[model samples]
Target: MNTSLKLKLGLLVFLLVLSVVTIVPSFYSATPDWWKKYMAPEGLRLGLDLQGGMHLVLKVDLKKAEENSLELAANDLKDTLSEQSVSAIRTPSVSPDTVIFTLPNTSSIEQVKKLVAEDFPDIDTKIESQEGSFPRIILTLKDAKKDYIKKHSVDQSLEIIRNRIDQFGVAEPVIIRQGEDEIVIQLPGVKDPKRAMKLLGDTAQLEFKLVAEPAGLNLNELIEKAKKSGQWKDGEDLKKLNRALQNQLPSDTTISFEKEVDPQTKVERITPLLLENKTLMTGEMVKDAQVRIGGTFNEPYVSLDLTGRGGKVFGQLTEKNVGRRMAIVLDNNVRSAPVIRERILGGSAQISGTFTHEEASDLAIVLRVGALPAPVDIIQNMTVGASLGQDSINKGLTSGVFGTIMVIGF
Candidate 1:
C-alpha cells in the first residue's frame, strides 16, 4: 500500500476500535472485568420508556403554601402590633390571602396601617367593619406577592424533589418543572416502584411541637359527636374531622392523627391527637440524619443531628418544658409524643416509628436533604415493566440490524 493510504487505513482502524469500545457497554448488561477496569465505566442511560421505570406527574399545592405564608404574616403582624403597645382585641383571622383583625380604637387602626405600610408593603390594609367600639381592618396579600409565592413554591418543590431523587441513587433521573404547578419525574430501572413512589410523594414536613396540656379535648368524643350528627362516619376523613372540630379546637392547639393498620382486621385506623400549633423546631434546621437500628429490638429509627443554632434552640426548649410532652410531627401526623424527660442537649434526637429498614432510610434521606417547600399530590403514576422495556430494545435492535444490512448490500 502507498504510505498515504496506509496512514488513512490505520487512522480508520483506530477510530473504529474507539467507537466500539465506547458503545459496547450500552448493549451488554455485564462487561468483562478487564473491560470495566480499563474502559469507561458509564453506559448510555435509557429513558423510562426504554428501561422500564416509574413515571410520575406531581401537582404542587401552591394554594396551601400561600395560605400558610399569609397565616405566618398575620401572626407576625399581631406580634409587631403587640410590641408597639397596640394590642389587637382578638387574634388575626387568616383567610386565603387576607388577615382580618379588630383593634380597640381608630388610633390603633391608623397605627396598624402605618406599620403595615412601612414593614409589610406587600399587604394592602382596608377597614373591614366596626364591631361595637372596635374597628376591624383587613390586610389583603397583594396579587403580585401571591403570584410570587405560587411561582416560588413550584420551583422549590422541583428542587426538593430533585434532591430527593439524587439521594435515592437513581442513575439518571428526569426531574423537571412541567407547567405552572406541575412537576414531571422519570426514574429509569427502578427495582421498587412502590418505594420510589412513596419516597417521591412524601412531603417530609417535620416539626417538633409541645403536646397540649390537659390534651385540649378528647378527639374521639368529637369524632363520635360528628358521627351522631351525620357529619362523620366510622372512618371519618381528615378534612371532615377538621371541619367538625374547627370551632371546638383551642386557639393555640391543632389536631393531628397517628395512623395504624390493625394486623388482625387489616383496617386502617387514625387516632387523633391535640397538639400545640407552635413549632419549637423544624427540619429546616436539621444538619444531618441517618438510619440506625435500636440496640434493644433491632428496630429501625431515624437519628437526627441539628445545626448549631438548632441545638441551642432545642436545648432551651427542652430545658423550659422538662415535664411536658413534645410531639414529633411529620406531614401533620404525630409520629411520637414523649415526655421531655429532663433537658435534652447536644442537638441529637431520634424518631422511632413502626418503620422497616427501607422506610427509615428513605426518611433519613429526605430529612438530611430538607423538607419540600409545598405539599405535592401524585396526579399520574405510570410504571413500565422490564419485559416491555426488553421488547422495545429488541425491536430497536432488529430495525438497526436491518438498516445496517441494507446499507452494506447497497
Candidate 2:
C-alpha cells in the first residue's frame, strides 16, 4: 500500500478497536473486571424501539388546575384592591369560581367593576348581594378563561416535564399531548422508571404567604398553644392539631408544621406556624432559578430572578409588611419564615439554606420548572419491550458494523 492508504487503514482500525472496546459490555451480559474498570462501563443505551423501557400515560387534573389559577387570581385581586385603597372583607364561604369580598358601598362597586373591566378582563364581576351599605362583589372566571385554563394546563405540564428530563440527562424522551387533558410519555432505557416519574411528576406548590398573627395572639403564643394542645402527642398529628385549634385561629389562615429531628438524640421536634390564604407570590413569578455559590459562607444557594411584575409585587409585599414573618412555603409547609427587615426592591432573591451541591442543583431545577399545581394521575405505567424485536436490532447493528468495515476496505 501507498503511504496515504496505509495511514487511512491505520486510522480506521483504531476507530474499530475503540468501538469494540466501548460496546463490549452491551453485547455481553457480564464484562471483565479489568475492562469495566478501564473501559466504558455504562455500555450502549438502546432506544425504545430496540430495548424494553417504561411507558406512561398521565391525566392532567384540569378542574384542579382551574381552581388553582382562580385561587391565585383571588389573591392578586385582593392585592390590587389594597393597592387602590379599596376596603374589602372576605365572605363566610367562598367558591372556586367566585371571589366574594364585601366592598365598602355602592360607590366602591363602580370602581371595582371598572378595575375588573380594565385589568382582569377574563373575570366577570358582579354584586352578589347589596345587603347593608357594603356590597358583596363576586368575580367569576369567564367561560373563555375556563377553556383557556384547560389548554394552558396541558401545555405548562408538557414544558415542565420536558425541562425536568433535559436537566436530569434523559435522552430521546417522547413526550406529547395525547388528548384534551392527557399526556403520553415514553422514556427509553430508563433503568429506574419510578424514580424518573417522581422527578417529573412532582406537583409541589411553591407560595410566599405571610406568616399569620391571629387577632388576639402572636406567633410565639400560637406555637405555645399548639404545644399545650391535646394533639401534641409525639408532635406528629399536625392535622389533628389544626382541627383542635381551627376555631381559635383567625379566618383565612391555617396552621402548618415543620419537623426537625435532632441528630444526637434522635428525637423529633415539630414547629407549628400559621400562614395566610393570600399568596403574595408564587413560582410562576420566578423567571429563572440557578444554583450559585455566594453569601458570606460561600455556600450553595438557589438564586431566583423574578419577572418585572413579580419584582414590583414582591417589593410592595415586603414594604407593606415590615417586621412581619414571610414564609417561603412549599407544598403547604414552611421552608423558612424570615422577618422582612427592610424593603427589598429589584428583581433578585435568594433561597438560603445549608445545602450541598446536589441538593441545591435539584432545588434549582424545581424552581426553574415552576410549581405545577396541576396534579398528574398516572393512568398507565408499565415496562414495554422493544417493538422492533431484538433480532431486528441485532441485524441493524450488524449492518452498521459491516458498512464501516466495507468503507475501510475500499
Candidate 3:
C-alpha cells in the first residue's frame, strides 16, 4: 500500500480498537484488573427501561405538608403570645390550614391580630365571636400561601430524594418531579429494590424535644382511649392519637410512640410517651451523620454532628433542662429519650435503636442528606429483574452484529 493509504488504514484500525475498548465493559461484567487500572473505567449506562431496574411513582402528600405548616404556625403563634404576655385560655387547635385559639380578653385579641399581621403575613386572622367572655380567633392560611407551600414542598422533596439516591451510590438515577405532586424515580441495577424503596419513602424528619416531666395523663389509658375512638391502631395513626389526646393532654404537651418489635415472637409493641410540642432543633441543622457501632452492645447506631447554630441551641437546651429527659424523634416516632446528665457542649449526639447495619447506614445517609419537606407515598412500584436486562442486551447485540455485517458487505 502507498503511504497515504497505509495512514488511512491505520487510522481506521485505531478507531475500531477505541470503539471496542469503550463498549466492552458494558458487555462483560468482569474485566481484567489491568484493563480497569489502565483503560477508561466508565461503561455505557442504560436506563431502567433498557437495563431493568426499579421504577417508582411517589405521590407527595402536599395536603399533609400544608397541615404541618399550619401546625408550625400555630406553635409560632403560641410563642408570640407568650412573648407578648398575652395569656391564652386554651392551646391552639391546628387543622390542615387553620389555627383556632381563644384569648383571655378582647384587648389581647387586637394585639394578637396585629402580631399575626406583622409576623405571620401568610395567615388571615378573623374574630370568631366570644365564647362566654373569652374572644375566639381563627387564623387561616391564605390560599396563595397554601399553594406556595405545596409547590415548595414538592420541589424540596425532589431535591432531597435526588441527594439520597446519589448518596446511595447509584451510578445514574433518574429522579424527576412529575406534574404538581408526583415524583418519578428510575433506579438502574439496584440489587435490593425493597431496601431502596424504604430509603426513598422515608421522610427522615428529625426533631429534638423535651419529654414532659410531670406527664399527667396515663399513656396506656390514652392508647386504650385512642383504640376505643377507632382512630388509632398499632401506633400508626398519629393524627388520630393527637385527636384522642386533645382533651386529655396538657396544654404544652403531645404524645408520640416508641415502636419495638420482638425478634422471637414478631409481635410489635408501642410505648407512648408525652413530649413537648415545641421543637428545639431539627435535622436541617445537622452538619454530618454516620453509622457507628455502640460500645456496650456492639449494635449499629447513628452519630450526629450539628451545625454551629444547632450546637448553640442544643447546648442551651441541655443546660437549661439538666436532668430532664430529651426525646430524639424521627418521623414522629420517638427513637430515644435519655436524661440530660450534663450540657452536651460540642454538638455531637448519638441515636441508638434496634437497627441492623444496613438500616443504620441508610438512616445516616438520609440524615446527612437532610429531611424531605413532606411525606411521599409510593403509588407505584415495579421491579425489573436482571434476566430482562440480559434479554435487552442480547437483542441489542444481535442487531449491532447484523448491521455491522451489512455495512461491511455493502
Candidate 2: segments with Cα more than 4 A from true spot: 1-45, 49-53, 92-94, 130-134, 192-194, 215-247, 261-268, 292-301, 307-322, 342-347, 352-359, 383-410
lDDT of 3 by residue, 1-410 (tens): 79999999999999999988887777776878667566747768877767778989999998888877777787788877988898765444544456678887777877888888888998888896655767888877889988898769988999999999998999889898899999999999898988999999999999999998563667888778778877787637686677767777777678888777664566877777889888988898899999998655688899999999989998999999999999999998899898999988998899987888999999999999988878899999989777766787789889999999999999
Clashing pairs in 1: none
Candidate numbers sorted by lDDT from highest down: 3, 1, 2
Instruction: For residues 1-410, write the lDDT of model 1, one tens digit per residue.
Output: 89999999999899979878877888876878678567856757787777788888999998878777776677778778878898774443534566677787877767887888888877878885555567888777789988898879888888888898999999889888887899999899999988998888888989999987564567788878988898767555665666667788777576677776554466876777778766778898899999998845577889999999999999999999989888899887787788998998998999986777999999999998788777789999988777877798899889988997998799
lDDT of 2 by residue, 1-410 (tens): 79999999999899979989998987787888889778986778777777878789999999888877776677777779889999777764435667688887778877888887888878877785544666788777889999988868899888888888788777788999998988898888778776677777778677888988756666556556767764454446555665556677787787886555454466866677888877778888999989999867687878889999989999998999999999887766676688999899988888766566766777788788777659888999988776565877789889998997998799
Error of 2 at 37 (Å): 17
Locate the minimum summed-lDDT window of 10 residues in model 2.
230-239
- Each candidate structure's TM-score, on Cα atoms with residue i matched to residue i, is 0.84, 0.73, 0.92
Q: How many angstroms is residue 329 displaced in model 3 relative to the true structure, after the best TM-score fit?
A: 0.7
Q: In angstroms, give how far residue 126 of model 3 lies from its true place.
A: 0.8
lDDT comparing candidate 2 with the true structure:
0.79
